[model samples]
Target: MKRVVFAVPGSLDTPTGGYAYDRRIMAELRQLGWDVECLDIGDGFPLPDEATRSAARSLLLEVPDGLPIVVDGLALGVLPDVAAEVASRHPLLGLVHHPLALEWGLSAERTDALHRSEQAALALVREVVVTSPTTAKLVASDYGVSADHITVARPGSDPAPRSRGSRSEVPHLLSVGTVVPRKGFDVLVAALATLAALPWQLTIAGDLTRDPNEAAKLDASISQHKLAGRVATPGAVSSERLAVLYDSADLFVLASRYEGYGMAYAEALSHGLPVIGTTAGAIPDTVPQEAGLLVAPGDVAELAEALRRVIADAELRRRLSEGALASARTLPTWQQSGAIFAAALEKLA
Candidate 1:
């Protein structure tokens, strides 16, 4: 039996796309009869430090030499010591949701630093697994990594839309993600402003990361737009509440300037909710022509128009909802993801 270790930034308690990916992958691999282990390198934001690097190295040393190890690109990018240690022994595999350097909003200094760090980390990895082709291309063009070395293995969703709710009377608009600038909540707000005459309510759900400044900005935006009654930002909801939100919502909007792979989009579609997203990053892969609407990034007018179309036309919403749900049911599970991953690992073995 082969032993596989997945290195991540933190525990499953604090959810992030990278964390979800690792958790699902480990679960699926375990089901497949591989001896699976997850090594949490510590959490918070930014990146790991020297002590975390030491912890990763300690974990690496514990794994037998030549073992297949998958490193979370989130924490690994910033840890050159960890990269150096992994390079000396195991065949390193990188699972990058998206490169930190390519995140939508970052200062020039931080972007450059992340770029340097990611380049160093990529140098040690034998294979790079990303959630989308956009990231695969970014890794090749920005980091000079070979495209052939990178594989795109996207995430799948299991949606549960509510059947009892009256969709016509209460048009629900849902947006999910950590309240961050890159996710484009500001753009969503701007779009909502355009639809002020409409009776629809918008719900924003996700952990508001402990950054007070960003939180203040989001609060101020909601106030400035005077969206108090119509907009809801219930920070950090449970999975059950999220499913309820998806079930009740008429449409899901992701105004992100960029995404590695829009898992929420898939989740919304799975719940039979039509999606509205920008034509940026991997979102195009999930939002089929019949399932959702795509607008140019930051185009509030376009989003508002799309919102109006979906809200006013019952037939259009019903058609797209059916299409989206069908698409979701057809999506691969994490077990399937593991099987494909195992095939990739076989070549290296």
Candidate 2:
């Protein structure tokens, strides 16, 4: 049987979109009879301390030399030395959801370090797989990795029921992602604050535990805007609960500063909800113009304007909803993406 080791940082069961992609892709590989070893290399990735790095290095070293190893970019980017050592014996591959250096709120030094290490790691890998086309371009150009070395396997979107919407005159706005600075939750909340005169209830649902200070600041912003009643931060929700949120919501919004491939936006499109997001990274690629309105990242005023128009105009919402469904139909299934991912690995052997 074909064999490979898939090393991911943290719990494979994490609720974030990146983890979800990892989970589905692995399942697809297994179904194809690949001997997939999903290894948890521990946490604090991309910025792991010495102890964490040592533990991760030891675990990776234990993998058989003949089997290919696909390391998630989260930890791999920062572990260039370990990757080089491992690549000397194994056919090493890198799965880059997005370049780690592109993440927001990093110090200049940290960004530079990540860039250097990732460049070094990518150079050693047999192949690099990215989650989005935009990422493919960036990695190739900025990181000096060849386009031929990179494969773009976009995230799959499952079929979802069209959003019935909040029957109430007041619209329900939904934004989902881990509450981190990179997500631009602060920008989203600021935009909503400006639209307080409008009748809207917002639910920013996703894991808040990744960055407690960011979550607390988000809470503080809601309170300062006198929007505690209208806005709900229910943290991470189960799949069932997120589905319900998508179904019952009138609109979806997330002013992310950057996305390797905005899976949340793709999920919103699949749900047939109008989107309000920034034109950052691969967001414009994920949420097409007909399906959503895009604003510049971190521009609260622009996002607020987009929000004001979509929430107030039902006809616009209907048009966008139709577009979202149209866009959703074109999205690949998990099985298809998985096949592509599996095929890439099959060729690696």
Candidate 3:
């Protein structure tokens, strides 16, 4: 039987896209008849303390030799010593949601530190799994990993009912992601504040606990713009609740400075909702121009213009929604994504 140990940091059921990808991939592997064991190595990853790092290393070392081990980049990038020590014993693979260093809003020194650490760890892995083509190219060029050594197993979208849209007089906007600087919820708020005269309501649904500072900043921005009534910032939501939010929304928006794959954007498209997002990172790759309006990342003016154009024009929204449905038909299914991941693991043995 095919067997492997999947090491991940934090809760397996975390609502973030990275965790969602891991959870789905693990499930898919089981469906494919692989003996998959999940190894939770603890959290505070990508910036874990020394104690957490040591504990993670010991947990990774516990995996039996010759059983392939796939470590999520969140933990692996910070555990260089663990990678080097176990590379020869267990066939090691890395699942990178995105390069850690490229995360927006990091100081130069922090970015440099993360880059060195991830580069060192990636060098020892047998193979790498990236979520998007843009990330694959960046990983190869920046981390010195060969293109042939990487697999791009994009997050799959389950077929969803086309959104019936808001029943309200005002257009409903939905944005989903953890409240963090990289997500640019602050930028979205800034853009929306300018268009308070427009008839629209926005709900920013994501984990507010992940980055308390950013969450606080977003709150301040909403108040500063005096848009407390038109905007909602509910924390992490249940699957059923998010589905309802998707069903009731007319437009989906996020001003993320960067995305490894933009799983939320894909989810929006799967729901047949028109998109308004930035062209940064893998967004353009995920959000086709025909289905959405793209703007420069962090540019408040451009984002505002895009938001105004989409919210104000019913014809544009309908056209983009149609395009979004067409694009949804082309995204891979979870079963297919799992097969690609399984094939990559099969190659290890």
lDDT of 1 by residue, 222-265 (tens): 89989988888898898888778776777788898888898888
Better of 1 and 2 by TM-score: 2
lDDT of 2 by residue, 64-130 (tens): 8778999999998999999988888888889999899999999999899889999998999988999
Q: Rank the candidates by TM-score, best first.
A: 3, 2, 1
Q: Which run of 10 residues does model 3 get worst, by summed lDDT?
A: 57-66
What are the Cα lDDT values of the candidates? 0.78, 0.91, 0.93
Backbone clash numbers for all candidates listed: 1, 0, 0
Error of 3 at 94 (Å): 0.4
Writing each residue's lDDT as its tens digit, candidate 3 over 1-349 gives 7898999998998889999999999999999999999999988988898888888888888788889999999999988888999897999999999999988889999999999999999999989999999999999999999999899999999999999999777999999999999999989999999899999999999999988988999999999999999999889999999999999999999999999999999999999999999998899888898899999999999999999999999999999999999999989999999999998898777
The full ranking of all candidates by lDDT, starting with the best, is 3, 2, 1
Best by lDDT: 3
Question: Any runs in candidate 2 off by more than 4 Å, and if so which?
Answer: none
